[model samples]
Target: MLTEKQIATETHKQKSKFVTVIHPEKLIATKTTEENNDNTFLISWLFLIGSLMFLLDGFIELSEGLSIHVLLHITASGVFTIASALFIPKK
Candidate 1:
């Protein structure tokens, strides 16, 4: 009768024969493509804030002056929407 500890050790040894354990560093080091896209969140947040500011500024301008700033804000909001969409991960 094998003890539980002994059985677990034997099972681990047998499983290790079929499994490969690669270190995280080694896996990252062997990547075929190096991506430099580290600022996705930063850019997204910046665009989001910029869109809000532009909208606000447009509203204030609407009270004071021309409709041009509002149009520009609408365009900027669209651009930021698309820019953030690009960074979203696909399932």
Candidate 2:
């Protein structure tokens, strides 16, 4: 049966224990915009190459006519495609 005032004081004490006192003006990004964009594109290109390899493997399995290997390759290719798509550049 704590009073509202008692509860608020306790809550304030707990919150203050975790409060960080950093100046907002001191925060900065380490990488330039162009550098970040280039890194993203490079990672996406590597993933795209892997996905392409899986796609080719799937096509080869298709020639064997409907098997688990084909299904697995297709599933892997689709997953890799989605992953790679996330890092692709907008421009």
Candidate 3:
């Protein structure tokens, strides 16, 4: 048995009790970017070392006769380089 005015007043009271808000998604994006950068840095280091080892082994094999040790080093370095290139993210 509420009047029109009473219903309106109750609606206004309920609306006043609730507030709307906005949130930014940039914070999450920034954290993700930072994590990617860290991973890229680590992978870059690994790639550089691996590339150097591969080159050194190639040079040794060229200057001297091919040995089992030199062959093993070359194979291992090649595998590391390929792995890093495939898995590393560019950020």
Candidate 4:
């Protein structure tokens, strides 16, 4: 029963009720290029160190035949060593 003009005006009124939305720009901590590179290098080194530890454990297992104690010792020492190195203060 509504005319075309009436429908158009009603739609316009509903759309105009919403205000324009503005989104804030993302805030990210910017690191220096050297620092960024250092982070990536440190990550790669960690991967390398982890793989080395796994390989070392494999070797220890082979030599020890079938001993869980030696395996546990090696794993614990590797973890502790890495943790200490990471926690140490840098000059």
How does each model score on lDDT? Answer: 0.67, 0.83, 0.75, 0.69
Task: For candidate 1, write residues 1-91 as lDDT tens digits.
Answer: 9999999999999888775679999977763432433355566667767766766666676677667756787677667666666755432
Please give the TM-score that candidate 3 achieves against the real structure: 0.43
User: Which ranking of candidates, highest TM-score first?
Assistant: 2, 3, 4, 1
> Candidate 3's residue-wise lDDT over 1-91, tens digit each?
9999999999999988976665578555566767778977897878877786786777678578777877777787777777766766655
TM-scores for the candidates: 0.38, 0.57, 0.43, 0.38
Clashes of each: 0, 0, 0, 0
54 Cα displacement, candidate 4 (Å): 1.2
List clashing residue pairs in candidate 2. none
Model 3 steric clash total: 0
Give Cα distance to truth, residue 12, candidate 3, Å. 44
**Residues 1-91 of candidate 2: C-alpha lDDT, one tens digit per residue:** 9999999999999888775777766666367889988898888889888887888888888898998878888888878878787768886
Question: Which residue pairs of candidate 4 clash?
Answer: none
lDDT of 4 by residue, 1-91 (tens): 9999999999999988977655554234566878877776677567657756765876667586757876776677677557645644343
Which residue pairs clash within candidate 3?
Answer: none
> Positional deviation of 73 in candidate 4, in angstroms?
16
